[model samples]
Target: MEGLFQRELDPRWARTANNASHWATGVLAGAQYGLVAGSVARPRIGYGVPLGAGLWGTGYAVLPAAGLYRPITSYDRATLAKDLGAHLLYGLTTAAAFAALGPARCRARKAG
Candidate 1:
């Protein structure tokens, strides 16, 4: 914000906004995964790796245009790898938690 908007956020507000956005992103991502997983005959935990990598790639694709990040090429391998690793971990955790709930099923009532 300071770099792009030329305005500084209050420390408290920054923390609050950061936390809120993180949680919101996680929830939204989880919802999308749940919907997709629930539709499949058997949702494998491994699918999360691709989901997470796709999300990471998406951020690289979009954030640069938004001025929030440099182009992917600008980052060194280590940096990219670290970020990717974090995303992968998040994806795995999400998949594991969902799997723990047992097989997915549609809870909708049948139309009479």
Candidate 2:
């Protein structure tokens, strides 16, 4: 078990793991937006819905790339509550849009 765990922990695997997860998450997110937009059952939700999805998807994809992107305004209880709520709201909107359309470029690195 020790050897098995060590093999799993190899740094080379990290690159592969992150890249695959990133792209898979991206595509699924786009599909999510497509589903949501379709659920409206309205013919009028054409460009805006899809466009918004793309914006959201891109935001999601790029967010991780930029590093810890969560913005916490303050640690005070009152301020923290407000910040948390706002961040959650922003996160949901960002996720919805990304799941709708964003797909970041991903390429697995060859072993060296």
Candidate 3:
């Protein structure tokens, strides 16, 4: 994962620090996704799928422009498929966790 990210970065920034930064970025991204998922009313698999897919689509458009990652078109089919699969999995897992936590439902339950 680090190697892949490093490849897209400028030579000066392509070092251990950048790899660590990438890992940190991933962690932060996961947290943001969790927060979004948790805020949903009923957090189900259906909800997660679209949320994750939307995020992936948005990242493809934004990340390259931001210089964080390469454009989706630059990657080969296998890499693109792998990334899509990973994003889907991340979304599904986040939704499952959110459903289990049931933040919105719990709030409603308590209020009622």
The TM-score between candidate 3 and the true structure equals 0.63
Q: Candidate 1 or 2, higher lDDT?
A: 1
Q: Please tell me which model should have the higher TM-score, number 1 or number 3.
A: 1
| lDDT of every predicted structure (CA atoms) | 0.77, 0.46, 0.71
What is the lDDT, from 0 to 100, of the residue 37 in candidate 1? 80
Clashing pairs in 1: none
lDDT of 2 by residue, 47-68 (tens): 4444444444464456435542
After superposition, the stretches of candidate 2 with alpha carbons farther than 4 Å from their true spots are 1-7, 41-112
Q: Worst 10-residue stretch by lDDT in candidate 1?
A: 103-112
Instruction: Kindly list the per-residue Cα lDDT of model 1 for residues 16-67, writing each as its tens digit.
Output: 7657766887799999998888777667789889888978898789756765
Summed backbone clashes in each candidate are: 0, 8, 0
- The sequence of per-residue lDDT tens digits that candidate 3 reaches over residues 8-86 is 4447766775568646755776688668766766667666687668767887887677666677888999988887887
Query: What ordering of candidates by TM-score runs from best to worst?
Result: 1, 3, 2
